[model samples]
Target: MEGNEMKAFMKRVDYLLVGILLFSLGLNFYHLNNAGTNTYYTAAVKSMMQNSHAFFYASFDPEGFITVDKPPVALWIQTLSAKIFGLSDFSVLLPEALAGVISVFLMYILVKPNFSRTAGLLSSLVLACSPIFVAVVRTNNVDSILILTLLIAAWAVMKAVDQKKLGWLILSVTLIGVGFNIKMLQAYMVVPAIFLFYWMAVKLTWKKRLLHLIAATVVMAGISLSWAVAVDSVPASERPYIGSSQTNSVLELAFGYNGIQRLLGQNKGTKSMGSASTAVQNKDNSSTTNTSNGQTPSNQSAAASGQAQGTTSSSNNQGAAVTDSSSSSNTQAPMGNGAPPNFQGGMGGKMGGGTGGMFGTGTAGPLRLFSSELSGQISWLLPFILFAVIGLFAEFRKTKKFDMRIKFAAFWLTWLIPMMIFFSMAQFFHQYYLSMMGPAIAALVGIGWTMLWNYFTTNDGWKSGLLPCGILTTFLFEALILNQNSQSKFLVVGTVLVGVILFILMVQRMKKETYSPALPMAALLALLILPLYWTGITINKTNNASTPIAGPGSGMGGMGGMGGMGGGARMAANMGFPGGAGNIAPEGAQDTSGNSASGSQTQDGSMTPPTNQDSASIPASAPANAGKTMDNRNQLNTALLSYLEKNYDGEKYFLATDSTQTAAPYILNTDYSVMAMGGFSGSDPALTPTKLEKMAKAGYVKFFLISGRGGMGGNQSESVTQWIKDNCEEVPSSEWQSATSSQIQTSFGRFGGETLYVYKD
Candidate 1:
């Protein structure tokens, strides 16, 4: 290409990138309030930035001691924006929105060199406008960061392959390492897929491949290990123990139980338990079978044991399993409890369970099984099928000689295979975990669409072209009809108008004397972007519904709904309360188990526990400093602080009935802490005994607040309500605590919520 032509091409690409960025910004900006807003990660990041003044020094709850889980990279970007722009919802989210736009630009640049300019443009546009991509990036989440890193890594790997540049290889490894810091071992999954693809491409001897593999391994290890070392250096008490570290806690919970455990319809550690029980059940069945056949049961046992050992030996041969005993040991706890156990011979349980007459009985909990099925349907498996089929054809045709097929194949594998293997072998799987694949899927669709368009227009001729045109025309017509019928609906009308315009352009192209293939594609790209943008706008507008507002009859600064206290009570009950209501010592509380006494029913129908029975109810006398009105700020702050000082010291009940309203107060108030156990319902004195007993044993309580108007009854699930009934304690006398109005204003205006409960163990 000539210098002027190259310059023009670059200019076009730049213009297109800017346009996409603006569209992305607008889409994300408008949809800030969507129900499916970013998850806990966004909240965590925002909290970190608010606490820490600097970008690199991210902290959450400066008064408290919780470090941010994600790496500094993304947080650093957000922190800078917050500091410079002034902290607000928009400021915190701008970094992700901008990164998302940049990632799209990078995707275009990476594809443009290998594919036609039209293909590059279409691919980038498709990714920019993908429903999932737009939704994920617009919200506050680590997904945008993951997408950015994956794109950079792909670009780096492509450069290395094309130029044989070791620098690019190192850079790619570094990016993966950084990705690991963002979310632990999740990033490492891409390595195996990338290496396998490379091996297939080069057909190199094992020794040659091993060298590259070792280099990549060392780089990944260095980056990940450094963070691990830092975390390990902290005292165990100070460490963030998000889950347990046992068969149920550490290996099972983190990897299998909480990881893929749900996929098999088991609890966090139930998969391991289920597997072990099945093994024992199989052994018992085998013994019975041999005895029935008039053969020595010992012989069958020995043979089964030998087979188990042999399988273990084979796994050991590949260093996959350390010993057969390992699986047996891990499965023992769950088996004893009659819970489903996960296979523990690394990933070897699949073979063992299959041969040993152990498979899912299909009686696993409906919710968990349904979740697992949905996860499998949406995750890497579906994308792999889509990409492999399209990628194979693209490679075979050799229409574009620029090696776009291999790059995409490599990129897809690198991101996908590792995650699939890890999750499949894990004890649990959740839909959110699959969010990482959104970008990869978007990229694949973009490329696939471009390839299909090219094939029809160039190879299959006019007949093939008519099919896409017809589909486009039909979409346009439907959109036009919807628009005319729903003029007030901005999203629907805007989408239809965009589709019609794009279809008209495509139709015009079909009739032109000489078609510029890019015209139709560009139009189609616009159609995709416009709808997604409109959808995002709608979501943001709808998210406002989540905000908690003050209403009439809401006591004390319009606070009415039970605070998170009620939820905490339910969680305590579910955990198996070790002590009786209020008498049982909490997990972190001082030991008073010996002094603690169980409760008996009172004449008023209250289950008055023996210890602190009188103190359990709110004190009748207000403090000497207490004033009549709660209108002043200082007085309110002092009263709130006093309330916290009195209430926050011991285990307190948390009610999570109103999650959306609850987060702000729980987050803002240091004196207040929450335990998310179950939903909220009106207070029932009759249910207090069992609930209080559970809370005492579990060492916590969640008091559900009931407004006179009847709060959150039919809306809550049976399991959730049952959990609350089983866990929480109700104290009827502890009502209507007085506060200065200033404290009320501070708590209500800054962190909107209705009722508050003091959780006691």
Candidate 2:
């Protein structure tokens, strides 16, 4: 390559990256416009930008009560972008979109040495335009940062291998550390892949290998530990709440909850693994009891433990304690009594024990069937696995002449395999978490594609190459068409017809003189881009036209649906809160008709069900209680509210509710402080009166509002309600009236038959 050629190549790369950047920008703008900031991460960013003038970092709550859950690296970039561009939805998401584009460029650069430029371009294009990648990039999430970090780390490691440079090794380790800082523990998963690459490339003696490992570990430790040390130096009061730990330090939260708890599920802070285990056991016991004797085992023991302390029953109930009681009527001997069995020693053993040793048992057939449903979720890993297999085959076939890139790919596979196995064994798995492997997957796929192309051309197999290329071109074209249809069916059909014509023209050229694979791939890329363009336009219009709907059922008028009752789905409506299509009453509003609205049925239906105005939405709010009648239910509510106000400082106190907006105005508008109650739902036996007492003791929550009639339909456990009645004093009607007057409440007027009970510790 001459100097001018190299310059031209670089210029082309720059042009490609810039084009991707603009494309990503348009997509993100559309998504933000359509969804108006979809996930919690985006909401957090928007909140920060709205409240704090600085963008580098913004607290989730205005009081700086909770810092953003994710690390500040991405947020800092986003904040700076917003500052320069002027904070709009687009500005807030610009950092992720840009990072996404840079990742594509990095992919091209990283793979260019191992594969042809065409292969590199195709891989980059696949990543840039893939629905999954584009979706992550368009949203304000940490996944994009994860992708960038992984790519940079992979590139650095490859550089080290190519140059035999310790500096590159250190740099790669440092980048891994940075990834950990962004998302705790996820970066470390790449180590196995990198180490495997090294071992395959240059086999070192055990002693040298040990030394290298130590050096790499030290570098990684330095990168990760620096943040911990800085965070630990801060005072306890300054730290966010980790579990129940006295120190709210960022380090404690990161290390204890995000880092350790995520892997081991042993965080002692808020919700401990022990408690979760115990809850599972209790649930099992109740189900068994119900089946055997038509009586549910009392969850009094679990209930008494409260929020601060989690309980794990002893292993006595293991055998008899069915993991899923719904499966079979046949009773097995009790494995143990208290805690669930800890079978982390062996993956198969753990899985078997957790599922009641059902793997081979024909009786446990239903459980196997249930597990099969998750196959689709794990399918994303297939592309990477396929690439790894191809790379391994390529490396072994060329053993006489070593390809450093192949060796590097081998190392990545080594790292990826162990991490995949570990995650698979570990009980918790989600597809998004696999995103860390996206770069490696892209690299492998690029290599595999190149290998196939070379094989055909070397064999004078132009006709064979035509078939595979044609197939790939068709697949890419169809994907584009389907994606485009998401915007407008007519537009996509027209585009597909035009693409068919272009494909025919390309085929003609191929027949004359084997046209470069790049030409067809480029055309396919254009087809894909078309849909995203229209998608961007749709999102922009949606954003511009959106109107804030009142939280569900407050009659603040907005879209309505069954899924609108819960905060998550309901907030998706214009108002960004509950009470849209399905939600009947707003957050605090209750149905006075004594007809318990089936909240359990709603929850069981779907997390985000489509809006069914007739069947889903709560038809009307409960009629107002006219006379100031003090009944047992009203007394219980009043006593709870009165006790909370009298014992706790009303100004500093907040009602513990799931709805933040509804709760916020009532608590914040009035001198009283409020925050959303974060915990398992009321149905969980884990929530006890003692837990409420502990929450009050820790100043986490001051009051608990108990609606007399169930609107959403799920009721508080009998044990929880009884405990509250026995231990805490309810607010008096007179005090409730006074507090109501003091608080500039939003949903209070709409509370049909709902009773607000405030209680003190």
Candidate 3:
């Protein structure tokens, strides 16, 4: 215990922590140069970097047509990165990657003081190799920065509690506010835990604590709303329409769409503006319904008008399935009235389902975090953490006295429990949102490990029993998950075997009345093997940037075939268990109804899923953008850009489309801006007839590209198409044909089949 010995020990710890951080950096930064990782966000970042105004508004297009659906703080960081590094796939994603790396070090700092250095290192290591954490930081998602900011706030709060410094507490609250800017209300999920920890551990009187919390709340609100207030102050005519807000209001977007609507999914009155438009566009009661239940009005109009116009065979073929191109070589019959709905709306009613039922609990419940669909994302070690939490509580109950360490455990639990409940029952969350649970799980694992080590190394036979019981239980849970989801028989058998061996070794060591670091180390290392292996797969394999979950049997953009996990559409079909080959639901392939991941057919719609080969051809980093209704295929077609530039001179907007997905690649590829007429879901009224007429008449938009099927559901208006047919002449597919790559054409459905039409009014 001499000073020199302590210094040497500390040096080794620092080196190990530094090494862990570097390892995380390598995983995140390894395939940095891949393009279009998540074109939705990448394109938005590119657009934001075009000018300061666009940057401030977080515009998804260069001309400030529409901002992205989320808050701009995270986008601001990415914009700054792109500005410094110059725009590329790597530049836009660098800030988040670096944030993730910093978070690893911060987790260690937050844990080491109250717990042993061993606990802190293990915690940091677990977080560093977390599968979802690795996947999220490597993408353009706002979550990486969001999670990091929250961790910083957590650290600040912990320090304030330990040191009794009011300033540290203030800084903590301020950082949470910053986190709110990064991801709106999602960051406030930890508030209850923060408040409780402060109240319990700050040593302040009840009155002082209440007043301090009020002040912190006020500051947090002021900081969180700073940008939202500024954006809302702008006139709708001046700023881009708030992309997903029902009333084009930032506040409404925050509290409504991204807030409650996300938590509740799509409820009666709380549907997103996009969903509303989709409903209107796809209303079944329309006059355009099948004239005889076998012939849709739109199809009738197409057939009659086509022959009247002396349509060529190619154009006739084009009318059936391709974009409204003049050169259609192959012809097919128009879709009959019995055709299935073209587009699925409102995530297929998955968002706002009822709460998980009672103690039995439904999808959104206390156990929702451990559900089949969610567990693999970040819950690989959840069973252990949960058991450790129970053990910690039991120990505190026995002592009947307040321990700072127990209080810290309380804060971590408080932080995790509510969020767990919220995510469990919340109807509309994506899997990546589970990363919010990462830090809590890591801290609990560390604290629990240290506590168990102390008990087991001593002669406390009864207390030591908790270790084997917890470890064995976790092993059983993981074994079940692996058996159901994994393709690797070796993995399942090996994991179970290792558990048995570790159990025996620990029991033997305890009985011998000996304390060997080797036995405990072996046990802990064995526990880590499975999750770390999965994390490695996540780092090496292609992730479906759209769904953004990591594990075996991921649908699209995954190494689906390797494990027993089903890949691609096959996994989508099975839907039996998490990480199973059939688990993934492609972005637009199915509604939230747990329906089969089969293709939706629109009678005349041009959209198609990428062929398996085409999907395989996608780079490890490139996530295809076809979910929902937008298709982001070959955005950088040199031929298309040159053609648009040559023929559509002086146009303010280079191209116009009905959905954001269709416009993303074009905006990203060209210096010119592209307008998404209806916003993300093709339901926004941003480009009504009047607006389109005004822009088209003014030469603001010279070319309109009709690449994919329309309708928020499958009810695209014939009037919209009729208006274009009446006012504009169809540009031949030949001019833009060069823009279609064989990769896109042969895999036609993959990128909405590149059905090109250049319409000039």
Candidate 4:
């Protein structure tokens, strides 16, 4: 413990941290350009880079017809990145990737002061390997940036608590307000946790604490609403229509479309994400209480002996399947509807009736996070988190006063528990949103493992049982998740074996009145192997940029082999992802819902299940932009791009389409302003016949990418279609579309076909 030795130890830790950050950088940046980009966001970034006006609004087109659905903070970062790196997929996604890397380092910084260096290091490592975290950051999604901002706030709060600085506390809340601009109410998800931790741990008079909090709250509200209020203050005639808002107001967009509607899964124009009760099951709704591997959740203690019954998986070296008897079936249930009635109104997700239920987040229930649809994305270490919480409570029970340990436990658990509740019950969310859980889970794992070892070597046999129990239980849970969802279900055995061997050694050493932390450290390393492999899958295979999810077969971008629209669509599907075997479900495809992965001709529109013997493709059959009601096929018609460019007459808008799905490819590929009439889901009532007629007459636009209400699902109005048909001339397919061009469905599934028209007075 002398200064020189301590300095050497610190040096080693720094080297290791640098190495881990390097690895994180590689994971975030590797194959990044080839990976699918959420063209919806990428197109917006393209337009945001055009000029200051579009940049400020996070406009989807250079003309600033409407803004992106969320606030502009994250997009603003992306815009600056594009400015520095130039407009390209890599530039657009660079901020997200860097954010992810910084968040990993922040995890270490946030944990090390309260916990130990060991806990901090382990936390960073765990976050770096988190599948969903890696998956989303690899895309153009805002979540990485959101998480990055939140983690910085967490660091500031730690400083606030540690240094007793009122200014630091204010700074923390101010940063949280900044996060609100990045993702709106999602930033508030962690607010309760932060405030509770502050009040409980700050050691001040309750009244002063309340006053300080009130002050912080005021600052947070001001910062959070700064842009929204500014934008709303502008006259409707001067500013673009607020995208995704029922009324052209920023506050409405915040409190409505991006707020409560998220909970109800009903925005305003799309399908009602019916609640959990409406889970669409196959013909067989009867439950038989079956575990795939014939093992029960409670019996996983055998994993301590490396003979955890079903821990032996032989299928493709996939990880082991944990058998939970509480679950009704071993089969991974495809996502079912999980929103309230009347909540319909997204870009494409059926408020009801489709298998891509509620953004493929799985049926809403207490166990939704463990559902196969989500487990691969974020639940790899979930059991560890649960056990960690229990261990902390038990170990710290005697500490009545709030110490740093208790304070941190409160911070991590508060941050973790509410998000668990939200994701478990809320209807509208993507899997990547689970990245918010990564830091808490990662930090808890490190702290919990440290505590687990401490109790294990205590010589109090009763108190020491947690280590074996934790290992066995986590192995069982992980095994089940892999069996039900992962292609690599056989990976469970090695980690279980290693943990079992270490447990045996620890017991023998305890008998001899000796202890070694190395045994526990080795065991923790073993547990991280599988998640690392999953991250690798995200780096190389996944290209479903719009709804970035990780794990085996996750890159189902072109839902029905509907190809990309242009070279940029390659950012979504055409990168040889497995799901695009074609419009036909590749011979043995099973829908994530247990239904056929692709839609079939059924009168009731109740997606039909596949035959029992059907094999698995990427797990979710309905997840890729089902929110927008479009099968996620980009099919950027280069010929169409050429056609429009060749006939360009210096118009303000090159092409106008019902929703972003149609306009995104053209916008990403060209500098031309392509107006997405209804915005993202094509459901926003941003424009009317009057607006369209004026724009057409003003020579602001010329060509219209017309589709029926079913084609692309956004604000495709009857009046708009009728007005276009009455006023414009239809362009023949031969003039632009190629003979061999397999038209990626520009419409929302089988509902409509897309046609081109010239807007002539």
Top-lDDT structure, candidate number: 4
Off by over 4 Å in 3: 1-13, 267-367, 555-639, 713-722, 738-761
Model 3 agreement with the true structure over 1-761: per-residue lDDT tens digits = 99999998887668888889998888778765541255556667777777887788887777777666677889999888867866665676788889889888888998898888888888898888788787778767788999998888888888887777778888888988888877788989998988899999998788888888888889889998988999878655567766644345678667765677456543323222223322222122122111111111111111111110000111000011111111110111111000112211233533223311110112565766565555666787887886687678778878998789998888989988887878776754556677888889888888988887777777675777667666776776667667656447887787788788788877877778568777776676667767777677765654344345666635332221222234333322122111122212122111111110111222332112222222332322223432211122222344555677788786677776654545654655455677655344433333334444555665666666553333211223234444565777777656764423423333333223333444454
Over 450-554, each residue of candidate 4 has an lDDT whose tens digit, in order, gives 777777788655657677567666766666766765345346565456556766765666675678788667767767777888788667763456556677643
Per-residue lDDT for 318-370 in model 1, tens only?
00111122222122211111111222443343322321111111112323212
lDDT of 2 at 617: 16
Cα lDDT, model 3, residue 536: 71
Show where candidate 1 strays beyond 4 Å.
1-13, 31-87, 196-207, 238-240, 243-258, 262-410, 413-435, 459-523, 526-534, 544-642, 645-664, 669-761
Candidate 3 residue-wise lDDT at 112: 90
Ten contiguous residues with the weakest lDDT in model 4: 308-317
What's the CA error at residue 284 for candidate 2, in Å?
22
Ordering by TM-score:
3, 4, 2, 1
Task: Please identify which of the two predictions, 1 or 3, would achieve the higher TM-score against the true structure.
Answer: 3
Every candidate's lDDT: 0.36, 0.40, 0.56, 0.59
Candidate 1 at residue 30, lDDT? 57
In candidate 2 the C-alpha lDDT for residue 382 amounts to 41
